[model samples]
Target: MNTESPVSRRAALCGIVVALAVPSGLVTACGSPAPSGTGSGSTPKQNGSTPTSASSGGALVALADVPEGGGAVVDGPGGKKIVVARISATEVKAYDATCTHQGSTVAEPSGGTITCQSHGSQFSPADGSVKKGPATTGLRAVAVRVQGDQVVLA
Candidate 1:
């Protein structure tokens, strides 16, 4: 005899749809607007080739933009979103803004942690490591270096 309740069956179907839609790129959660050439279906542009708001003539952002022990979300190489954090006065780190769990753009780092609003995933700005659930994988690291007064892709 079928013992599955109607509510349970509906919930299961909804779960299936979300599972399929997320991986298939049919759904995108909370995040900043992705650049024109960068999306799940589109091929990401090569580094140093795509122009972004954060980068100008090879500079990703001004060092002043990132506060000490905090971070900012900037348009990154390949037209992708990147989170740049200032660990110390002379130290900085960068990571792909897309959350590993669901592709939602991570929020700016506060208290040395990056948070994903979509699913509440937390990541450490120090090494892009996941510190919360729903995201088992860490954020992708992006090479970054400080040049004079600006942050540039390394």
Candidate 2:
């Protein structure tokens, strides 16, 4: 009565192996890099109020100078500039130093947001999203990364 166990155990093991194999294959296919260098989270093509232009390729800034939860604006190349913010110990965000509303430079960060002094436009320093009126478009985010003790614009 209780002697028929070997075949059933083998069948169960095979079924479990098949289940795992199927899901693993699916995950591998789903997790793959794009051919281009840029991966997911590509920059938004739609421009806010400000005209999107080439970044000024400004100087490398020190992370310590940028206060946590605050930011600093610095001039860049070709008269362009950048806004640097330290979101956290490991995260930093950069945006085009120019204000999107009227091409004026965005003022200092205020409570996690950047306000345009020229026209009172506000943008999210976290990711450069438009937060207030007179500027319906979000701030153009510039890629930046930390290398050693200095943060470099990427």
Candidate 3:
């Protein structure tokens, strides 16, 4: 009563294997931390800015490294990605860089907005508020402070 061809059966099995393998690979890649000293250990001088003291919170890029109106993506606590933006000369904000839409790492903030490249979601740097759809929720906030020129967790 079975009429499935051998080739067709093999193709279906391959498809199933691929479907399962791809997702597992993606999940592992997404959770793995960025290489050390490249994400969180970047310095102000390395970022094309003035040098600053290395403080706690893992010494994320210096205060001077973050542009005045734009932001930078750096490694945060536990190797999680974080977006650090300077709203003004004296004001700065920090938020989770993971996109709320689908967990894609968000791009650096520009023009005062954080954008997700995967789904075109946008967020506010001031309060981590959702500025566009596809991402109905805002990014999570991360406590940060300026200490002796370095930006550290508050």
Candidate 4:
């Protein structure tokens, strides 16, 4: 009697889900509107002026917006939802926010780990590797680099 879509949960966080044979690249989403700003209810630290994501392939978020030891889930390249973690002062790491065990979007990194609230799964901020169970696999890596003061798609 309960026939819900498998990716229904994802749609809640993404507003749209593109499941066409599982593309290995950045999956476009509606986490936020493009050509404007970042998502997650937090404003990115601005410098002079903001440029559309097109100018940077995809600007995930401002480097300062992401805490030194924590992370934030934000609108990524092509509007995809991605989790970006600040590893060190100048180093960073990023991954597809979607939980590998299920389709639920993973939580923002905290305490040096990214957690899946849906299934008690945990992943490493260092490499997106699985550190806990319910998920035998690790999160997908989303290529990104710190450009100037922004974390951008690579």
Candidate 5:
């Protein structure tokens, strides 16, 4: 008779993996991933340009793309969508394109209002405030500024 019981192959491999992977911080599947591209693949190139960080003021879109009294939906940081509205010639405001009511994406600001086609939610372009029904809350504000002729994340 064998003096000691044999351990299964799966058990041995699990032990080896935990010993090696845990110590090196390679085991990350235990919890859910992060939001806002906070996970492993956050740094991505946009518009075929070099990767830029918010601390360094990343360019989002050209100023000409956004009309004087209207706004334009553009790709924001972490692959998120945002509405960049031109408040005036030298001022711009931005907000999350995701609608607060039902997680729908809001459209560009037209006639001085950003409209969500999903539920007819209208928001103010200057301050991201709710202006119509179906949406009780306004779109979330995104930190951004106009840098030269480019709209950049601030």
Candidate 6:
């Protein structure tokens, strides 16, 4: 016959307790980052300039996809998320979608600016600057380019 040490039993109990406390959705038994990208391994690229039509690299996104006089949040390169806006026929800009005040996602474009729904903070769509507060700092700008007919936010 064999006896288990008190420490061993205690560790086993602790593990069971932790397993119960963690949320089911937060735990990933596989321990892997989620699979990304189509199996084709092809991704749109930034041409170092903005694309003119409704496509980028080869992934085509319509300018109509963005709201008139506003912006839209889109999946950026490498699975990063970004906010893109069409300020004018010849002007477009992109910025990191996260807010500076408390790391909340910025609100979708409205009334010609992007506002933080979490704290009522406002920012200019053209430059991503704080138009009003609890956010004292401006939004972070990302490089934007046009490739083929798509607007690429790098």
Per-candidate TM vs. native?
A: 0.63, 0.62, 0.63, 0.63, 0.65, 0.58
In order, what is each prediction's RMSD in angstroms?
9.9, 16.9, 11.1, 13.2, 9.7, 9.3
Report, for every candidate in turn, its global Cα lDDT versus the true structure.
Answer: 0.77, 0.71, 0.76, 0.75, 0.77, 0.66
1-154 per-residue lDDT for model 5 (tens digits): 8899899886677666666773333334323233445444544433222233444488888999989999899988778888889999989888878888999899998998999999898988878888897888767666678888999888
Q: Candidate 1, residues 24-58: lDDT per residue as tens digits?
A: 34333323233465544433333322212334347
Model 1 misplacement above 4 A:
1-57
Error of 5 at 132 (Å): 0.6
Local error of candidate 3 at 122, Å? 0.3
Error of 4 at 110 (Å): 0.3
| Clashes per candidate, residues 3 or more apart or on different chains | 1, 0, 0, 0, 0, 10
Off by over 4 Å in 6: 1-61
lDDT for each residue of candidate 4 in 28-54, tens digit (9 for 90 to 100): 444434433334233232221121233
Candidate 4 TM-score, true structure as reference: 0.63
Query: What shift in Å separates residue 20 of candidate 6 from its native position after superposition?
Result: 24
Which candidate tops TM-score? 5
Q: How many angstroms is residue 3 displaced in model 3 relative to the true structure, after the best TM-score fit?
A: 34
The residue pairs that clash in candidate 4, if any, are none
- Residue lDDT tens for model 6, 1-154: 6695456775666566557755432233324333455242333433332222222343323566766578788766565557777787646677777888998888668789898889998988877888899988887776665554566543
User: Which pairs clash inside model 1?
Assistant: 54-60
TM-score, candidate 2, is: 0.62
